[model samples]
Target: MAYDSAHGFSCDCGQTEWQVSKTAKGSQVVCYCTDCQAHLRHLDRVDLLHDGGTYIYQTTPDAVTLIKGHENLALQRLGPNGMMRYYTSCCKTPVANTLSKATLPFVGLPLKGEDPRLGPVICHAHTDKGTSGRKQTGFAAAGWGILIRAARAILSGRRASPFFTDAGEPVIHPTVLTREERRIASLRR
Candidate 1:
């Protein structure tokens, strides 16, 4: 539950592996935004959803390090301006979401269970957009935390993101979904 220790994660097929360092700033949350749901649906990975939401650890980019299978990493977006979504082409496992530019220093790592190391869900974001019927709370706190960490990351000049190059470019090009694909994925089941 503490970021004071390292945590590792991998794709379903184990082809891609990554780790978050002990000193990384992060928070856990269950996000139920339509965009998040649509992303999973687009990948045919609805199985990753729990109670109509995805559990994620929101952290700074400098915190992550790709351990292996970098070649298998792929990128996508719901639309031209959507967040960059990373996944493993080997098995279509959702990896993380980040701003189009790595300089922003944020990554939302999709997780499976309530791994105690992630600490706790600091927020239930966009609950109104989900079918779980849960009330939304703590979003403000989470937002503040993210902003604070982001500022700190920027100030510290920590730019060693696994998802980006030293020059602040994405590790791979992104594929933007078509309008039709987005519509279909956004449809409520």
Candidate 2:
């Protein structure tokens, strides 16, 4: 379960865990690129960065681990024949879960259930490899919103961009989607 401090979390089994600071106050975005899709296949999850990846990107490797039941780890590559797609053996969770602490530190292990902790994914990579017409999604969707909010945030004389603000923090209250998302969803329906 997630900790209040926003720095660490322990799983129900106590075997898997991860941690990251949730002090930052920005909206988290989702990605659906080939890499992400491939990762989904490898992880055997339909929700990669969407429903997942909230805790995975925040925790330190030391804070995350599988205390037991490790015989279920699995690995495979999805994109090209040369690429490697790593995942769990039984559940096929994200490959991000099983990486060595030595090489990957910034990445986190995705949890089974929880509101993902991510902000408008400001950037994306490898757009050229998109299988569908959709590429470079979140940045555009959230760019205007982010810029508008960031501008109002800390206009402290053009320093580096800040990812948090008291004004634009996560809302515990329920809110409706914008006209755009509603329109799209309605059309799809």
The CA lDDT of each predicted structure is 0.87, 0.37
**Shift in Å, residue 84, candidate 1:** 0.3
On residues 23-85, what C-alpha lDDT tens digit does candidate 2 reach at each position?
533433344344454455333454433422222232232333333344443443331232233
Candidate 2: regions farther than 4 A off: 7-17, 21-35, 42-86, 95-104, 108-116, 131-189
All predictions: root-mean-square deviation over Cα? 2.5, 14.7
Model 2: lDDT of residue 73: 38
Q: Identify the runs in model 1 with alpha carbons over 4 angstroms from their true place.
A: 1-5
Instruction: Give one digit per residue, the lDDT tens place, for model 1 in 1-189.
Output: 213367988898988888888677799999999889999988888888877799989999888888889999999999999999999999999898999887677899999756688787899999988778999989999999888899898898876788888887888999999999999997735
Best by lDDT: 1
